[model samples]
Target: MARIQIDLPEHFGFSTAIPVYLSHINYSGHVDNALLLTLVTEARVRYFQSLGYTEMDVEGVGIILADAAVQYKSEAFHGEIMDISMTATDFNKYGCDLLWRMRDQVSGREVARGKSGIVFFDYGTHRIAPVPPAFRQLFE
Candidate 1:
């Protein structure tokens, strides 16, 4: 079977640290695959916050995740801090891709690589909107 491949940028515009708690572990004693998305979601929020925007208000328009993909590289155990880095790429009229990489902060071992396709949406209008200039500027 073919696997997902995420090509990360050479430099990340944002990074955040997340510690794996016991709750994040699976029956196999490592972080569950599903929880990796959760961690990336948290990193995405911090990425926006670093740019002074929220998920619901990124330069006046909210973001709706259009799609997501994750490629696991290594196992992460509970009680370890993961360093997640992200950047915006593959921009379009109304959306862009947020690519991410995660590694163990202590061991420098890669845990996962992923990307989320996000579209700007106007909640009141209930329609897709153009990418806000301010939001795009940060990625430039």
Candidate 2:
């Protein structure tokens, strides 16, 4: 079987720092694979907040993560600060891809690279919505 390969962008539109806690460590003493998803989730929320939006209120529609893929590079240990960078790409009528890269802040070693496919959703109607123009403008 082929492993998932994520080619991260050279530049990211947003970045934030998050500290790895003991809870994030697995039995092997490094950050767990599952926990990296949570880290990216946090970063994604923060990225939206910085764009003057929230998970439930971006450009008059919420967002639903359609899918995700991650490629692990190095182990991240507890007490280490992870630098996460994010950007949007692969736009369609109703969705786009949010690319992310996580690295050890101090050593500058890449920890993981991933992308989440996000689609605009109308929670009230329980259906997919078109990508908001204002939201697209942020990257334009």
Question: Quick one: best TM-score, which candidate?
Answer: 2
| Residue-level lDDT tens digits of model 2 in 29-81 | 99999998999999999999999999999978999999999999999999999
Worst 10 residues of 2 by lDDT: 131-140
Poorly placed runs, candidate 1 (over 4 Å): none
Looking at model 1, how many pairs of residues clash? 0
Give the Å shift of residue 13 in candidate 2: 0.8
Candidate 1 per-residue C-alpha lDDT over 41-135 given as tens digits, one digit per residue, 9 for 90 to 100: 99999999998889999878899999998889999999999999999999999999999999999999999998899999999999999999887
TM-score of every model versus the real structure: 0.97, 0.97
Clashing residue pairs for model 2:
none
Model 1 whole-model lDDT (C-alpha atoms): 0.92
- How much does candidate 2 score in TM-score? 0.97
Error of 1 at 72 (Å): 0.2
- Clashing residue pairs for model 1: none
